[model samples]
Target: MAASVTRVFVSHLAGLPVFDPGGDQVGRVRDLVAMLRVGRRPPRLLGMVVEVLSRRRIFLPMTRVTGIESGQIVTTGVLNVRRFEQRPTERLVLGELLDRRVQLVDSEEGATVLDVSIRRLPARRDWEIDKVFVRRGRGGALRRKGETLTVEWSAVTGFSLEEDSQSAESLVATFERLRPVDVANALHHLSPKRRAEVAAALDDDRLADVLEELPEDDQVEILGKLKEERAADVLEAMDPDDAADLLSELPEEDKERLLALMRPDEAADVRRLLSYEERTAGGLMTTEPIVLRPDATIADALARVRQQDLSPALAAQVYVCRPPEETPTGRYLGTIHFQRLLRDPPFTLVGSMVDSDLPPLAPDTPLRAVTSYLAAYNMVAAPVVDESGSLLGAVTVDDVLDHLLPDDWRETDFEESEHG
Candidate 1:
């Protein structure tokens, strides 16, 4: 390896900023495209898929890149604005290579690939996969098991540039284990048609979760491609606030049409949120959260928190109210943090553990005020109550952040690159 050349993981290069010789940023690197060939050697790097300012993806041939380093990539100061069309020979590192299952030449058991390390070849003109990180074994094994190991690329088999039934299943199964944001990232790097196919393959809840993590444009695009009824179900599966946010971005006619397709109660909740200004608490909260009567036992509260579909932020605290449990009815009472519930005896009433000191948020409260309130109390979610002292929803920190970040924040992929 040349002293000047950096050996970096494919993950590190995925979103690095690309700049021209003049130091002007042209776009962010979305994926490294490469071609497999007939030798023991790794596939050769063909170019980069760059997502430019127009949100259109373009191909930058390897010859145009001058250098790769921490934080950014230096290019030959030239680029083509045309959308990228992958040749039959090309494959994406982040999208197609990561999370693949490959078999060892000497072993029948398959290993799940974690990541691949890539390095520039001699003359500093081309990059290729150098090493693969793989995990093997199950926890219940009596012998050596459940370990992650790194090996030369030649040690593994089953990687191919062509798409096969098994390859598609491997990809789908691997993606099933990833976080929603990770899935969204992989989806973003796929072609629009492929993205739609994958979205359709995912269950409604999983697809909804993944869609929540995608850019608004991508969210709209994938939803637009789904059947109207299916799209409505996916939206209904998403958090009310997130679904509302997505709906608010659609053209009025489209928004109303989709809303009409949704379940009446879910549509009503989204409609209520739509009435609030985009920058207010009402606009940032999910209409459904774990709400229990003040007299509910700690065991009951804990059970609510344990619901599989409750998001971490929403599960962090449970709102205490005088209730018709679905929506607070009797009156606004107080709140119970999950930590408190865990510490109290199961027989203890939530009313006894309520954090009465923390003030409830008014539905119309500005986003800025909500941010301050959460920071002041170190709360992940704050309850939103109407003037009638009925719980409206709970504004979560994640929602606040979604609004605070720049519109194109998802596209700004520069990371603190490592020197290796």
Candidate 2:
């Protein structure tokens, strides 16, 4: 039998020489650009996208592998490395999934990569992979020991591609594992019907996450490609703020159609957020804050983190408080950065960490004022409270910066500044 693919797979590339299929060294193998699994189990290596330079990347099919030695990934190509251009990291969802750590769900089958796909524009050519998700696949391990055969995808010789080129299968094989933005970009490469089918195949939470990351124009375009119900389902799964923002940007007819398609509760949540201007803290935060009583132990707070696994932005910090009391009027309290909690004494009352006795502001707090407040406080984040002073959500420093300095404009003044 031929050598096992696992033995040949290059997981480490400390001194791996990267050559232009021409044998001239262009650069050393900097990193595993992206790993795409072709089939269902043993997560067969369909294609490997590699970084050619700090700014450039190239795709190589696993089939081209001549060999894997002590510190190198040998390739069979003879093409110029300069031919490939660099894709923006924001658009590289495959890169994200390949890097993200995930639970492998130990079994006889090979591990999988889970990722979020995204799109850049309505008429863009391809989708992108934004975040890395490894240990992504899940399947069964044989219950009985004797009859079990743990076969990997590479070990099976019959798996063939349409073309001998490994690059051809890389995109399709990595379908489920691509980033949300990348998914949107890839759909642009497919027929509308096929795009809809892929959209349907995606899980709701994953779809929701991706939808939030996509550009508004791409979000609408992808939504247009989706079947009405599937489109609504994905929207419903998205964070209320993001869904609201997308809905607010959509045309009246499509907005109505999507909202009608969603469940009443979800629709209402989206509607509330839609009513707010996208630049506000309310527009930036998920209303679902993981709140705990001030008296709750660190263990109790951590249990909530495991249970809900809040979104990254929200989970940046967990808010501590008292259970709703008799008055239920002024539960105004402070927030705790997750890192702070980890470093503090385990038994310490979270109430002690409430840094800002300042009441949470209305979501309508002016952008200029928000920036000033955050800067003055040197805070990474601040809770957005309602009239009751109860924590509604948080406003991250980045979110404030996005409002103060949107992507559409350039910072001309900073180009010549020495004032700071």
lDDT of 2: 0.52
Top-TM-score candidate index:
1
Q: lDDT score, residue 175, model 1?
A: 67
Task: Name the TM-score of candidate 2.
Answer: 0.57
* lDDT string, candidate 1, 1-420, tens digits: 232775777666666788998888888887788887775577778888887755667899887877886678888988987778788787787667766667776676677677888777776677778888887743345776568988888888878734332223334554654678767876887778668768887889999999988888899999999999999999999988889989988999999999999999889999999999888988888889888887789999889899998889999998888867665355778888888787878999888878787788988899899999999999899999888988888999988998888887775532111220
lDDT score for candidate 1 against the true structure: 0.80
lDDT of 2 by residue, 97-173 (tens): 22222322333333333333221222432222222223323333853222223233333322222212112112344
Off by over 4 Å in 1: 1-89, 93-170, 414-420
Output the number of the lDDT-best candidate.
1
Local error of candidate 2 at residue 271 (angstroms): 1.7
Can you give the TM-score per candidate against the true fold? 0.65, 0.57
On the 0 to 100 scale, the lDDT of residue 40 in model 1 is 57
